[model samples]
Target chain A: MKRNVVSLTIAVLFLTLAVTGVMGFFLPFNILTVSVHALLGFVFIGSIALHLKNNFRQLKNYFTSKTALLVILCVAALVAVILLQPKPVLAILGLSKNLGPAADRFELKDTKMIYNYTPAPHYKMQLNFKGGRAFDAEKPPRVAIWLENTSRYHLKTLYHSKAPDAQQMLPYWHYKKSEYEKYKAESEAAEKAGKKQSEDVDALSSATPNESFDPADYIVPKDPEKETPYRLLIEINAPDDGNEHYPDQPSLVYVVEVDNKHPRSYQVLDLVGYPKSEMDEEEGEIEWSLLYADGTITTAHDLFDSALLLIERSDPIK
Target chain B: MKRHFFVISLLMLISVWVFFAIKAGEEKTSYQSFQGNIFGTRYQVQYHAHEQLDMDAAEIQAQVEKLLQRIDKIASTWKANSEISRYNRAVAKDEFQLSDELREIITLSEQLKTSTGGAFDIHHQGEEIDVSAIAKGYAVDRIAEYLHDELAIQNFLVEIGGEVKARGHNAKAEPWKVAIYIPPSHSHIVGPRVTLSNTSIATSGLYFRENHIKNAETGHAPDHDLLSCSVIHPSNTTADALATALYVMGAEAGLAWADQNEVEAIFIKSDGSIIKSVQAQR
Candidate 1:
């Protein structure tokens, strides 16, 4: 009886040590998980081997009775795995994931070795090219201060070695300090007043006027300086400004930009209608609306100031 | 007996573990940097800086330097006694005995002139066949090829002036983006993100190198309506030649020529409007 009691105590202690070792690891107060596991494993192996050796006949009968249960459990688990993991079969047929429209993955390539990249920065600018709805066709162009950077800094760090050195870097510009104060009233005057993102990409590297940050927006000009490479971007404004005067609405409009390789004056090359279904065959023409710094408004056929280009992919894909 | 055996085994195991723990602390990676002269310019080359030195970089640089010196010797009109000077004095009299590099430029120039229909040409003026406009592009391509093939560099970017060739993904797997500056004020970018890879992009702008873009057959230098024109091609030399040609031809014929030749291009009209080749837009 004393031997039985000692064995029972030892088995209980062994199980307790195994559970404790598995649950606890690396804490200052419980750092002996590995050591405990090692000792318990040694004890468990010896004790189990001896117990089975003493009960060999009973162990054989127990396994024979549990065979059907073990087989059923394995089959059920296999079925569950098959149902949940249909991707392998779908992929085999090449019919797996069909990411919807605007699901393109952009792949950029380095273009440094082909040019005689002087110890001077090259410019590639992307800007906003805005457009008005069909109800407002006669808005004409504006003498807008477009945003542009002379610095040819890339967004990716991996290409830093290939990028032009600081001596050869281009120039950059940012949005106005009081752009909201200057344009808020004018924007409110529009029939469907909307939020406008700042056009200054330099704003990203520099400190903002306020904590306010939003993407830039532009309306297409009747004539965009054509001799330069300019990109464009557009931001949609909410009607009420949503309690915040310059809220960045969830929606976006259009993007504009020119290639920075050749910087020159601005002109509009082509324009396309919004929403393909509602697109009119106007030969991609746009009337510009000028909202300038001096509060006075006059529209024209072209727009080219500090900014010239912008680029963006369609939603999800972007 | 069992207690003695356990103590002996424990001591042996601890000694082996202590030895391994001490040895692991000594492992580390080594690095090195290299520098040299090539094409009459100095190059500071940095690599993983392993113990194994690359003989190819030194050999290739030497080869390139000699080629440049030879080209300089022949291309200068002032060196009346040299091969290039004599050729410049009377290009019609002699089919010049040229080196392999010079021959490649000559053939490429003629081929581009024929195919892009004058949008890519190296002129034979008076006595010299001037491939000056396209030289940098070719240099970049050749140097890049040497680095990739001979030296086995997988991720590298090389530039010759404004022309550039890039290969391999960025360390972060992002495509390499190039920026181009607007001319007149060549300090600012007309746009910021121009993406390219494994190929070359060259831009010719009115902001630099006056009178180099005159009409070849007529020599009539029209007022440039293009602030800049860039051609993206399989090679830097082709892009360089194409950029010059497109700038001379303007948007109308230049685009048609690009399409017919199947090279990608972007032309910036003097008014700041841009026209991109279908391939580039794609």
Candidate 2:
């Protein structure tokens, strides 16, 4: 009776391990399956030991036989094959590791920004404005603040002056706005035609808000955790500010490429260049580009005393 | 005898190879995925159809988004005109009228509050009723139901802000697997992974450095050693609420409560040790 009970326990434990092991292979990485398999495996080993001790006389005879040698060799070969971790077995294991939803796993490359506080409702961009020597209360410079990807694609206009000539005053922003409008029109036309449209245009159109100068319209990213490196451009131009270069000085554009991956508390915008456009000789198309500021930019440089962009979070790091 | 043993081993290897080949052949269905921002977070839905799907992925995404927007309109506190917001703004009275959706959610929250011994509460002292904690889970459950009933989708997984509800199997015809993430910081360290079919899993963690979850009884964030708590149940709403309640209850009481209630839970402590409830161990 004692021998039968011990042998039965071994059989039951072996069956349980086999079922759980197969489940562990086919199913996702389940904690319960792993725990049960691991806990029972130890008990299975103990039961095997008891069985060997109970039938020691018969087991010793089988150990010296050729059949026992063949079984030992087969088991050893199986262990060696698994321990080698061949490509096929490794690939199978990789599938088990990826058994969950893609969203559940976080890749190191996904974390581009580290904020002091939670990204949403806390991360903000604060621009400190100081009046320059050429600052006039009656005719303030038409300022446009916008973000652009590294490829110089206009993402969204954060703030734009509500003046009627605001578009004309900021020629670079006007060119980008026209380009965006053209893309938007094309995307809508494509959508209406039931044809696949460029996702870039859709993303841009959705992010670009309606033309409204409400204070509430000046909204930053609600969550900046996934934000990549982008150029923050500020275009300022005073109408009729003529200099030696031409009858009117072109708008001055200030740029600062903010990379959330490597963040800083504050960054000063550097004057990159002004928008320079020329009529194409062959196609009669206007080509818009940026030109370095020359001696003609006199008062345009003084449009702001010092524009500083401060990155602020609700809770500062100690 | 030697020849017999060699032949038997060769036959065993061939049988194993054929079994794997058949399994690989059956896993041919491709999954359709839809993802968008919802409820101040992100949501994803993945499903595969054994038969023809009535709508394309985009149309299904629009329907899901509409459903989630309706729920947001009912429960979102950030929206000034939401149903819950209106209820919060109303003067304290013996009775107040609420929309059916709001009433259902509020009723569910009240039930959870009692079941958890006041560990989970939408109403805080001098604070507006915020159902944001349970809203995502509810949205997930609703989307899963819509996929099953309206679309006739048998295999689907819905996740909103980490709250997940999976029904049937994946495209591979295996149970859907979900990974639990380490909390307080968004890291690559994955905790326990659970496989499910017609089940939901919700994890609540101290996401911010500042205490975010508050105990309804004391109206203060409980100081506990728990880094995160994950609950598994048939209902995402219950799982989501219990995850928060368990976090407030801490590790010891939470483990006991889970076992007593026969709720499946996994608690990760501050010292990085894990404790599984009795049901979860099985």
Model 1 complex DockQ against the native:
0.01
In angstroms, the error of model 1 at B181 is 2.6
- Model 2, A243-264: lDDT tens per residue? 7777878898988777554578
DockQ of each: 0.01, 0.01
Off by over 4 Å in 2: A1-318, B1-29, B92-95, B183-190
True-vs-predicted CA distance for residue A208, candidate 1, Å: 36
User: Looking at candidate 2, what is the lDDT of residue A220?
Assistant: 31
User: After best superposition, candidate 2 residue B207: deviation in angstroms?
Assistant: 2.6
**Lowest summed-lDDT stretch of 10 residues in model 1 chain A?**
A202-211
RMSD of 1: 25.7
In candidate 1, stretches whose alpha carbon ends up further than 4 angstroms from where it belongs are A1-318, B1-83, B90-95, B124-127, B171-173, B184-189
lDDT of 2 by residue, B1-282 (tens): 999999999999999999998876655535778775556555678888555776888788878877987897788775567788788888863366787777888889999988888888888656568887788878888898899998889888888867888888876568887766553232333356678789888888764223457777766677777778889999988898889899899999999999999999999876778899999999
